[model samples]
Target: MINFESQNLICRFRGIVLQSILWNNDVKSTKYTIKEMIAHHSCLELPEGKSITKADTLEDLAQLYELDDYYWAVKNIHPLTHDLNYVL
Candidate 1:
């Protein structure tokens, strides 16, 4: 059970990392950590757009983009397949 939990955590972390890479590349302007990107997405603001000071809480973050939640939901897949998963 612990192993399974660890694997899940790894998968989720990897997924976040891959998603951060994609988001960074998609914008091609500012580079953001996974946390920052998640927060930005939660605020419904582009990384290159105006700064958001309201996404301080996880619930506040949750209201930004429905897509972000979707992204986090499957963040544990292989990195090579992230592009395909992200498109769907």
Candidate 2:
């Protein structure tokens, strides 16, 4: 696993070319923060001040995604937006 400093954060989204198997809802395939996506798909909790390492490049993200089905293309988004969504 790549070690990451908390200063840099990365996100992901399912590639448009991948077909959604379940529903016709394309909304479910929209870009999502990697942290949120991982939290939902795995029991592992991200460290309090750590983020995915080597996620700075698309190649890295693709390799990470290949390791597990939880990842997708790299996306950059606000870290706190997940919490704000819950509050709103």
Candidate 1 TM-score versus the reference: 0.28
Worst 10 residues of 2 by lDDT: 16-25
What are the lDDT figures for the candidates, one per model?
0.41, 0.33
Pairs of residues clashing in candidate 2? none
- The sequence of per-residue lDDT tens digits that candidate 1 reaches over residues 7-28 is 6643553554345444433322
lDDT by residue for model 2 (19-43), tens:
2211222322322345455556543
Report model 2's TM-score to 2 decimal places: 0.27
Superposed on all Cα atoms, the candidates' RMSDs to the truth, in angstroms, are 14.1, 13.6
| Model 1 worst lDDT window (10 residues) | 24-33
